[model samples]
Target chain A: MNRETAFNLVLAAVLLAAPVIAFAANEPFYVALATRIAILALAAAGLNLALGFGGLVSFGHAAFFGIGGYVAGIFASHAMYSEPLPFGLPATDQMPVIWLVAALLCALAALPIGAISLRTTGVYFIMITLAFAQMIYYFAISWPAYGGEDGLSIPVRNSFVGLNTANALHFFLICYAVLMAALALTWRIRDSRFGMALQAARQNEVRLAAVGIRPFRIRLTAFVLSAVLTGLAGALFADLNRFASPSMMSWHMSGELIVLVILGGTGRLFGPVAGAILYVLLEYALGGMTERWQLFLGLILLGVVLFARGGVVGLVAGKARYD
Target chain B: MTEPVIEIHNLAKSFGGLRATDDVSLTLRRGEIHALIGPNGAGKSTLIHQICGTLMPDSGSIRLLGQDITTLDAAARAQLGLGRTFQISSLAPDFSVLRNVMLAVQGRQRSSFRFFGNVMADRSLTDPAMKALSQVGLETRAAIPASELSHGERRQLEIAIALALGSKALLLDEPMAGMGKDGSRALTDLLDVLRRDTPILLVEHDMDAVFALADRISVLVYGRIVASGSVAEIRENPEVRAAYLGARP
Candidate 1:
């Protein structure tokens, strides 16, 4: 196996072993921490598809993440009150159902957003995405139906058939499973015909156009797919915390996702997972030492950008053969 | 003779007040190399752009395989089998040489939307791409990244891409711009062989390569075709010599 595949295998094994060891050791908090890593990794992997492979520097991905969070929150809230939605749609709290709805909604939202924002590129593209996310963020705060700024709480965690999701270890396993499946999907896409086109669009748009593959369409498809993955991660995130807030849709959340992608290694299969682990560990460790932990994180990010253009995975695995 | 694969009629383009390509016209017929030779700033590139659908002509129609494609965009024109190589090499630098040509094969096949199949192992793409590479004598260098290739090899790769597209006609811009004597000679040989099946509209400043290979020659001077005839006729025309070839060393 290649070094990247080997490294990914080890990373996956360590993640799986982390929660199992935590459960055996009765460290429920660590299980929750591990779950947070997996969910964040999943979200960052979504951004990686656009940012890393497609060269779309989106700063509005939180809009999809928030959409996914709210989907879970609204469904669970309606189920609690035994009230049908505005369209007379019955509410449900099943994890798979929530995931499907979240993915669909995110895809729908991304279509228009991608179509408009893809017209501009570079910093303008980044600003347009940031602007879209801010619009969604303010709308969520002002709407107030789902507790507005205060957010909605899930009194009971969403149900999964044959699984006791209320248990911290079992919930971590669920998130881990979802993260693995998403990564596998990512792996498949990275080597597919579509993947070749997306990377070509990123590298040289004129060449792609000359070859008769529309760069705009390739990028739009990637943008929408990326949004769908991030949205699903958001649903899982909300269920993990038993809460969904407007904060989930904030610009800082979008920035954090970008940070995670860069930190792990852009375009590397296991980069986001490695990045999420490092980010969470640093946040927890540094947050305990002082409140201004972000200052340190910023310095580290600078170092990575200046010295390690390939990020953590690049450092460990070497440059990708084709990249 | 076979019908002309591409026909440009009364093509004109302007940039502000300066006429870039004024009333330019050309044609590429089967089994022929149509060479467009000119001094720098003579509007050859502009004329080429109009033909490839990168720049819209103010008034003209371009018929490719007898279909009017004057209004089509670059990608649409390319999809209609109008393939071109850039004056400056524009390639996916990160991709392997094989993958670059496979992208062209994929473009020709119009199956870039396939998301599940591993493109590296897909024989449908690889077979055609490999064949194109071999046509250009680049099959052995297929596994290396395109960025690592020497300048001449990038030119060959671009031809391989155009070949893999199954181009009805080719618009090659400055294919031997920065090449040694041997490099240009090898390319001249390749183009001569390529013209047997696919018609070429070659835009080149290399007069040796142009005179040696052109089945028909057109000389453009200051946005107009100053002379058009067989290679022998153009060589004998004093006006063509005075305007272009005579002035060149």
Candidate 2:
């Protein structure tokens, strides 16, 4: 195999092994840390679909992420209180059911956001998406139904097909599996006909139209699909922390997701994973060293943008054979 | 005579105080290359844009295959068998030559919403794409990215993509703009054969290629069709000579 493929395999192996090793060593915190990497990578993978492949710089993905988190938080809360949810549907603590709700909610939310935001391009697209996210952020803070700015805490972790999800190892495995699945899905999309059309839309919407594809529809579909994946990650993240708050939907979260995608390699498959590992590790290492860890992170990001154009994956894997 | 595949009637477009396409009308007959030529800023591109639905006219009707398409968007127009190439060589630079054409092939087939199948492995898309590339003599460079191709090759790739879309009519804008003598001659020959199946509305600055390929020539001056006829009639027209052909031999 080529160096890039080898590096990718090694990274996946390391992620898988690190958690298992930590679980054996009785270090639940390290296992949770690994789970955080997987979940964050999945979120970044979602953003990469629109930003990297579709050339849509959506600066408001945190809205979908927050929506997913709220779905989980609200559902768990209703179930804990033994209260019926809206529309006569009982609150569900089943992981699969929660995932379905999160995905559907994200798709529903993304539709209107994408429809309005997609009408503009370049800086306008970025700002409009951010605006939409901010609107949601403020709404979440003002709406006291769920804890508002202080956030709602899940009394208990959600169940997953009889698995002991309270065990950090079990949760880590689940997140790892989902991350791998998301990675595979990203790869499949990169080679699919829709993927080709989406990339074409990014490069030249006019050319895409000349050949009979509606660039707007293709991008909107991609945007919704992207939101769904990120939303799934958010659901998992809420379960991991047992909390959902306005911070989950903040503009800062959106910016950080974009940063992760860029840090790895915008369009590369394993770029998000590599970026997540680097980002989380840096936060741990630098935050432990100094309170102003963001300054160092900013310097590193500047270096990546200026000197390492391809990102971590690009630096190690070399130029992509496909693009 | 065969019916015109594309018919534009009383088309007019204005930018503020400037009339870019002023009450212009034209016809692109079946199985013929109708060349639209004029001096720079004579609204040749503007007229083409109106016909292609890139720019809407202030007043007029455009009919493609006997269907009124004046109100349609560019994508809707293309779905009705209208294909176009830009003067600036627009393409998916990140996509390989084969994949670029594959997108066109897929456009003509079922919906592009197929999210599961690996397009690279799908013979239905690649086979037709490769066939179109072969027609444009770009099959050998199928694996190379569109941005990696030379300027002349990118032009050829444009034709290949149009062919893959199964276009009934082509709007070629400056297809020979940046080509060398030999490249232009090659493309001219390709167009000569291509017109047999698909009619072309060719907007070009290359007078030699135009004269060699256009079955009918329309000269536009200041957004007006100053002259329209066969080569001999256009060559003899005093207005055409005074406005455009004067610069050439």
Which candidate's DockQ is highest?
Answer: 1
Residue-level lDDT of model 1, residues A1-323, one tens digit each, is 88888989999999999989998999998999999999999999999999988989999999999999999888888888889876999888889999999999999999999999999999999999999999999999998888898998988889899999999988999999999999999889989999999999999999998989999998999999999999999999999998999999999999999999999999888999999999999999999999999999999999999999888899989887663
Candidate 2 lDDT = 0.92
Q: What tens digits encode model 2's per-residue C-alpha lDDT throughout B142-192?
A: 999998999999999999999999998999999999899999999999999
- As for candidate 1, its clashing pairs are none
**iRMS of candidate 2, Å:** 1.5
lDDT of 2 at B110: 47
Give each model a TM-score.
Answer: 0.98, 0.98
Considering only chain B, report the TM-score of each candidate against the true chain B.
0.97, 0.97
Q: Which stretches of candidate 1 lie over 4 Å from their true place?
A: B246-249
Q: What DockQ does each prediction reach against the true complex? A: 0.77, 0.73
